[model samples]
Target: MKITSDLKYLIIAVIAVFLVVNLSGCGENPTEMQNQPTPYELPDIPGFPKNLNIPADNPMTVEGVELGRYLFYDGRLAGSSHPDSMMTCATCHVQKNAFEAGIDNPRFPGGKTRGLPSAEYPEGKETPHYMLPLFNLVYNHNGYLWNGWVSEENQKLGSEAYGVPAEEPFNFRNLESLVWMTIEAPHEVNGDIEKSVRMIESIDKYPPMFEKAFGTPEVNIDRMSKAIAQFLRSIVSYNSKFHRYLRQEATLSEAELRGHNLFFSEEADCFHCHGGSILMTTNEYFNNAKDSVFNEERDRFVVTGDPLDIGAYKAPSLLNIELTAPYMHDGRFKNLDEVIDFYSEGLVYSEYVHPLMKNVREGGVQLSDQEKEDLKAFLLALTDHQMVNDPAYSKPSDLP
Candidate 1:
């Protein structure tokens, strides 16, 4: 039978619609067509905690971590192209020093990190505190920094006073916030977010990396923060001699074993803050009686606003303590020996001193020279040589 004119037109229209739908997909945004990211899994480290503090919004991805490694080393991240103005996270957080500027670091003498030099402060503004090691931070739930200021519990938003708009991602919440904060802080990169973003976006190689990491070629401060944070979290240090000893894969020397006993014993009482888990830190804040007078306003009290926390600071993980020298928040101790001496017989008494320092009234644990040497030996056992030399954590030979 012959078809009606109306029926013939309807068939043509349907065919046209089908063709359009099929062709439209072929021209869709490359970002929309990108594959989902591969999830990054932590290595199964024996005796280490299984929980990680990764934010749901920013899941760990292999692509993200790789991109972060490049960004962490690229001096252009500071929004400057000049050689003199160049500064990156790795500038201060050298891998060899367990991500801290070592006391013997040729650049920053005594491990005191400083930001890019500006006319306001020609010598470069000194960082508020000594650098903390960047290992196994994925498991840290207590917070980041000596004062625990970069925390989820902190309600303060990024201030225009500091060059960033008051916003959600700008708050002191996680490793991501810490990245941008470092960029904006006067004592760090001392950069503008928009400027840095523009600089990164203009780089030819980064867009593809951005696409791989975030399913888009778009580069922004938020993505930068997340990528860097992912890289930071991926840094693990569970292969130290101490860890190997725990796994029964290695043996400690007699001196190291003796020091280990002293560390955990009530006589030395060094385990209260630095022990209890394989992480080697309770990750809690305490006033360790470093000084009788509290003057620095950047202590834990600044974050918690509690009087008792006046001079308190987060007990940093001691996994790479041997490498990360010029100890304490202010880099007060030049060497581990000085630190041990202070804890052994130089502890000053103060009401704010943590109760865990049981021998504070007696000026410390009062260990002998032999005991100090033994303790030093034990501390060295905690060093992870692999971490300091890991190629994955090192700066890429070629950066965009």
Candidate 2:
């Protein structure tokens, strides 16, 4: 397992994570090779947390996070026909409900839909969108689902279903060709992207495991979408309990340090777009208040068709976010005191609000009920509990 052209020149600090996991030949060769790129000097990923993103054609290793946790619990490489009702990606990602993203919310496969996602249907077929829990999924900045429409140009690993845009889908170019037409997109793993590219062309150990996680031994369709985008770029997350009280190694009591000082004070300006060190958002997109899931919409007019992306999404990543609750972007607030009373006083004040959602109708972010239980005790100290029981992203111990 060694080819090292100085480790494929480690993609020179991940040239946009190898142009977002080598999106179709990462080429048009403009010549920038100061020795290819090597960013993952690597550490802290045990249950992941030191703010992870990695892409320069996928930089982290331990054999590409053990083959992206065996292609994230392989549903025989989800494109279809392998179905004995075996819909992998942990059949709606449940690592103890932290991977809660909904594939389509029929109260997710039955009931209780926080981030909705619970498939395994065949007896009647209805579930979708109840599965949005991939837990700070490598520091969430809009890529997965719930109208956020999958991101980073469907980071490779080839059954070919790639496309992304924030939210609003009543068939936008047939849901952007259902992200590379799910290769056999009869409707989510129904199967036939050329028989899922001939089921990885009769897998002889997946062509040197896609040439040892993609230096390229060849598989087709952008190296099988860069080996399922190198197993979802190895889903990273930070060590929580507010990152050991933001690395003072641990100490936040007193109502989670006064809800982490009114969430990085300036009187709750809430760290201007949920700032770095694993708040992991800030790619820029907001609408803050006024987001009743785009109620017959206008404003943040759905990801800047202008008219202000109406209720602009993607400001997630409060890490483990109190175990991914019934929050926003259509999950609708159920706690964190109704998400701090919708950021204190149901924010709707707009001209597309989010100037850190200021003075919501004049009395905003003023916060009470003891500062909304000190901002839900500083968002339950960004809960980590060893990345929700990391048996290396659980439920796949040689699955039966």
Candidate 3:
């Protein structure tokens, strides 16, 4: 039978439909899509609080933590592979120094951390403050950084200061934000995020790591930061002699016991700021009479713009205080003796001085030298030798 014009048109329509259906890939199998990465089970840490503040976007994963471990120690996190230009998160945070750059650091003397040499800051750039120890970070739900700048509620889409991508809003949430910030900060990595992503992607091993951790071989700052944050959160230090005493696994000496009492009593007034079960820090900002006058540009005022917050800084955890000397925000005190002496008789009253410092009017708590020695012994009990030498937190030997 001869086909008419109407029949011919119908045939053409059927052929077009078939072609479109096949080209659209509707026949492709679901197996071709990437498999979801396995969720990581976080270890139960002693004395840690029940409720954690992990971000909904980036849950912990074993592969992710492993990837973060490599990134945390690799100098390329700064977007450079050159030996002379190398700098990593580990650059300022050494494992032996309780993850803080201690005063004995030969490279950055006085425990003042510096980043890779940059044209804007030649001869390397020094961080405004001393490095905070990297332990019990998972407990820091209130915020990160000394001034409590990188907080949960304060995180936003982009900052001209950091050049965060606009499309990725709310990227800077929790410890993850710190990773990106450090990469861009002049006094930290002095790196560009786009460049960092590119450098990491170029590494043959990293793409597979990304796949294992994030279910894709793609590389980006978000993934990098999340992985690094995972590794950071995994760093817990609760095996100290003090922690052991609490667990009934060990005992403190007579002097240590006396110092412990003094630290928690009205006579010492240290527990109000540095006391807690899991972490020694209350994780709150305080002035602590560092100076009577404060610089609005510096101190907690820079972040909050609140006059009362002038000179206020985070009370760092004393978990590994012995290994983390010289102490304080600027690494001013050389040892525990100097630190105790300052608190004993060096407090200068200020309007913003934390009310916890009830003895500020008396210059300080005024502990006798003997008492000072006792206090030092107790603080030393907080040192966790195992944490400093933990093989898990160390740099991977395979990496060049």
lDDT tens digits, residues 4-62, model 1? 99999999999999999988986676556655688898898877887889999999999
For each candidate in turn, the TM-score is: 0.91, 0.31, 0.89
Best to worst by TM-score, what's the order? 1, 3, 2
Q: Number of clashing pairs, model 1?
A: 0
On TM-score, the stronger of 1 and 2 is: 1
RMSD of 2: 20.5
Clashing pairs in 1: none
- lDDT by residue (tens digit), candidate 3, 1-400: 9999999999999999999988677546444344556677666766677677678888988889899999999988777788887778998899999999888899888788887787888977888888789988887787788887778767466767766665563255588888888888888888878878888999899999998888778998889989999999888898999988998999999999999999989899899899955588889889998688775455777778888788888999999999898788877889888889889999999888888888889989999988998999999999999888988899999887
Tens-digit lDDT track of model 2 for 284-327: 56777754445533223443366566666656666666666666
2 or 3, which is superior by lDDT?
A: 3
Candidate 2's error at 39, in angstroms? Answer: 26
lDDT of 2 at 234: 47
Backbone N/Cα/C clashes per model: 0, 63, 1
Query: RMSDs, each prediction?
Result: 5.8, 20.5, 8.4
Highest TM-score, which number? 1
